[model samples]
Target: MGQKTALGSLLKRIGNSNQGKVVPGWGATPVMAFVGAMLIIFLLIMLNIYNQSVLLQGFSVDWNGV
Candidate 1:
């Protein structure tokens, strides 16, 4: 119940704030852009690795081996 009340107050405070304020030391836009760029890079690298694995060396399963 206490946790619920605290969460409700926090939500109400956030709702009341129309003027956006970024946390000190780091602006939101730059952090978001950096995170987005990193995500894209990671996805590209994963795709390349997957392509190499599937296209260059095919996967096969032998029932006898299993």
Candidate 2:
């Protein structure tokens, strides 16, 4: 019925509108956190590889003494 459709539309509009906030954005927090965590993880992995490579090379260089 027309009344049913109108009521459903009104409910949808009310749910979708964010009543006014100081900052406007629906999904900035989780997205930013995900990106930041990924960046930190990538940097940590790179650092670990660099450290392991250096330690291996150092040991190889001193193999004759050991």
Candidate 3:
């Protein structure tokens, strides 16, 4: 109980401290956008790889029963 109150107050104080502050270089929105773009690119690349693997598997042949 006491610990929770202390943590809550600490978080509130920290939040209040940053309310009117200015951060330099690449704020949250641009950073988040960049991260989102990178994630999308990564997902596309992975999807392409998976599709190619599946297509290649379709072309594989077994010659053990002659």
Highest lDDT, which number?
3
Alpha-carbon local distance difference test for all models: 0.72, 0.73, 0.74
lDDT of predicted model 3: 0.74
Q: Which regions of candidate 3 are displaced past 4 Å?
A: 1-12, 15-26, 53-66
- Candidate 2 C-alpha lDDT tens digits along 22-60: 675665889989999999999987777656753544444
Q: What is candidate 1's CA lDDT for residue 26?
A: 62
- Give a tens-digit lDDT track for model 3, residues 1-66: 345588888999888987878989776988899999999999987777656643554443335533
Error of 2 at 7 (Å): 43
Give me the runs in candidate 1 sitting further than 4 Å from their true place: 1-14, 17-26, 53-66
Put down candidate 1 lDDT per residue, 1-66, tens digits, no spaces.
345588888988889786676567765888899999999999987776656643544543435655
Candidate 1 global CA lDDT score? 0.72
TM-score of each: 0.45, 0.42, 0.45
